[model samples]
Target: MSGGILSPLDRAIVRATQEGLPLVERPYHAVAEAVGTTPEEVMARMERLLAAGVIRRIGLVPNHYALGYGFNGMTVWDVADEDIAEAGLLVGNLDFVSHCYHRPRHLPHWPYSLFAMIHAKEKAAADALVASIAQLLGPLSRGHLVLFSSRILKKTGLRL
Candidate 1:
């Protein structure tokens, strides 16, 4: 069985995990040094967190826009409730899909529930990708595309 709320140490670990460890070759070791724990302990706690579903994943964010792939879009889908998960899984696996999630749809006016992002080297490429996704989804899916014009804000890391 799992315990109650997170302990202070565990909270610290979570925060550290989000803010990221030092960028050195031995990043975990640096984190351990800052958190006053051993690298092995940090690794063990991270594993436990994963097992407990406290954290889904640890990943690095690449600056795709800076790499000249500035054309990005959020493609929203109005999919059957039962097929949302299946469609999400299928779309999420696409190489161009950077993020995917489900959101509540407002009736009468809005009907999109599943959202996925497609990033490409140009707007035409992104548009074609969205068209391909729509064709792949076929008659069961309905949606629209919203292209990102500018990056107004950006943030990395999280606070526990």
Candidate 2:
């Protein structure tokens, strides 16, 4: 939809921001120069795009590993369906959980309905966080597991 409706300047803005905003005081100014527009105009265009749901997110994505968070575990749980919504909100609000959401379950093989990502500086810390989450879920959880990430993958440019 955006591809067809966006002006050339807007398209350039999308390309320029595909990776991320420049790490500078006036990132929008830099973007304006790249797209041949004024900073205020760029900001206005961005606001319009966001209002139109063309841009979904604009925020800092912290580098946990760089900040001494060495262990990353994607904790998945098989929670009671009726209780998943409440449990997910609880887990998602936890200080130690970076991401928490509900996903579909593939029964007979993979049955995890709740997914939460826990990060820590060490394996023990990550494990402790997982334990806390398990305890929090208690009887509402059917089963759970941790899928540890062994390596960090660089974030490349736009997917499409």
Candidate 3:
């Protein structure tokens, strides 16, 4: 784990990909070229970094708005603690859901514990998607709300 610290070469690799991996047929090769290493080395280091929890994940963060998915909503659900696991799995597996997970409720003001982000083409479609999740959950779902995004937020990964 290197004492949970990033080595110089590892720092360089992270810097090269902090913004995002280069758009290329071989992204690792591009990262290697940028960091003065080889493709295989980059891949190996990345694997080790991931295993050591230095890097949480490496995946695409598509601009949903640009893709015509203008109605982006984060659906929050008030599912009983006992049914959170089942509810999360049911909502998370929906085709339109991009991500879903459980969170601690903040009490009186905020009671939702399950959150799922959904993207759709229109408001009606987004509402329908939420309804579908409610139907799937049935009695397990206490309440829910879809909070639409107001603006785009800059997304980035670890920075060296």
Instruction: Write out the backbone clash pairs for model 1.
Output: none
**Which pairs of residues collide in model 3?**
none
| All candidates in order of lDDT, best leading | 3, 2, 1
Each model's TM-score, in the order given? 0.84, 0.89, 0.94
Q: Candidate 3: minimum summed lDDT over ten consecutive residues — where?
A: 151-160
- How do the candidates rank by TM-score, highest first? 3, 2, 1
- Cα shift from native, residue 28, model 3 (Å): 1.3
Score each candidate by Cα lDDT: 0.80, 0.89, 0.91
- What TM-score does prediction 1 earn? 0.84
At residue 3, what lDDT does model 3 achieve?
A: 86
Error of 1 at 73 (Å): 0.8
Q: Which ten residues in a row have the lowest lDDT in candidate 1?
A: 151-160
Count clashes in each candidate, considering only residues at least 3 apart in sequence or on different chains. Answer: 0, 0, 0
lDDT of 3 at 145: 88
lDDT of 1 by residue, 9-61 (tens): 77778877786656799988988887899999888888888788787777777
